[model samples]
Target: MAYKITSQCISCKLCLSVCPTGAIKVVDGNHWIDSELCTNCDGSIHTVPQCKAGCPTADGCVKQPSDYWEGWFANYNRVLAKLTNKQDYWENWRNTYSQKFSEKLQKHQGQVPA
Candidate 1:
């Protein structure tokens, strides 16, 4: 089975940078994993799917049952193509990511040793 990116994604693009197979896609703010290109990182290079590990949001990347994943791409694309508000969707995601990043940075900065 392959992984899929859910609505919880914050558009950080970490998954894209870490994906070895280049299976994860972000087109017009719609993110999805191409099962055809996704190997789930089964090989020795990584113990976990990089996309999942790199994703900051809990449950951002999820596994799909093999049967359900078979035709997921076509249907997903069909639905996303109908949406016309991609710019707003992308901006919202970017804002969310920036806010979370700022919060985490502040928390970590507080722990700096003197």
Candidate 2:
């Protein structure tokens, strides 16, 4: 199974560099995981999925949930576009971007994506 990056992400590129499958990517100025290319580090040298191991947030990177689907990408894109400005988004990242992203996803999808 593949892993996912959640709104808890702080834009740190740690996950990007550690993913053995190169599944992590920057999309519309935010990090994303390409499930097709993800390996969950099952066969890789790392005992754990590197992305999760490297991520700083408590739950920023995690195994993809059953509810995750294609439509969520559009929701993610729409939400990210509104939250991508560094000055406005990152200055208070922990409380601002992550919280707003969760609130927006709950509003748009009727639940948080992750």
Candidate 3:
């Protein structure tokens, strides 16, 4: 299972360096586990990831996500929105981009390829 960093991570960088896959990331003032990279090699275990060797306890590395994890990307599209939550300009651009991308994706998926 992917190792998730709980709120109890204590902001320590220990596990950050131990993960062999380098799937750990610090975002929104906390550590995050990328499920896409998590292999779940341990059997019958909860959150005791070997990658988190430096963590003080199992509880420290296990946790559910916070309500507003989007806080980390506050400036990802800053060129448009004044703030991440405030969809001012960048938000509009994102919608436009997604619409175009969606159309192209559908077109490509339906192609018979000559």
Q: What C-alpha lDDT do the candidate models reach, one value each?
A: 0.82, 0.82, 0.64
lDDT of 2 by residue, 1-79 (tens): 6788888899989888888889999988799999999989988899989999889896688777556675477568656
- lDDT tens digits by residue: candidate 1, 55-101: 88866787765676555875576468645436587788889999999
Q: Rank the candidates by lDDT, best first.
A: 2, 1, 3
Return the TM-score for candidate 1, rounded to 2 decimals. 0.56
TM-score list, all predictions = 0.56, 0.57, 0.43
> Which residue pairs of candidate 1 clash?
none
Ten-residue region with minimum lDDT total, candidate 2: 65-74
Q: On a 0 to 100 scale, what is the lDDT of residue 79 in model 1?
A: 60
Model 1 segments more than 4 A misplaced? 67-114
lDDT of 1 at 72: 89
The number of clashing residue pairs in each candidate reads 0, 0, 3
lDDT of 3 at 87: 50
State the displacement of the C-alpha of residue 105, model 3, in Å, after optimal TM-score superposition: 72
All candidates: CA RMSD in angstroms? 18.5, 15.6, 15.4
lDDT of 1: 0.82
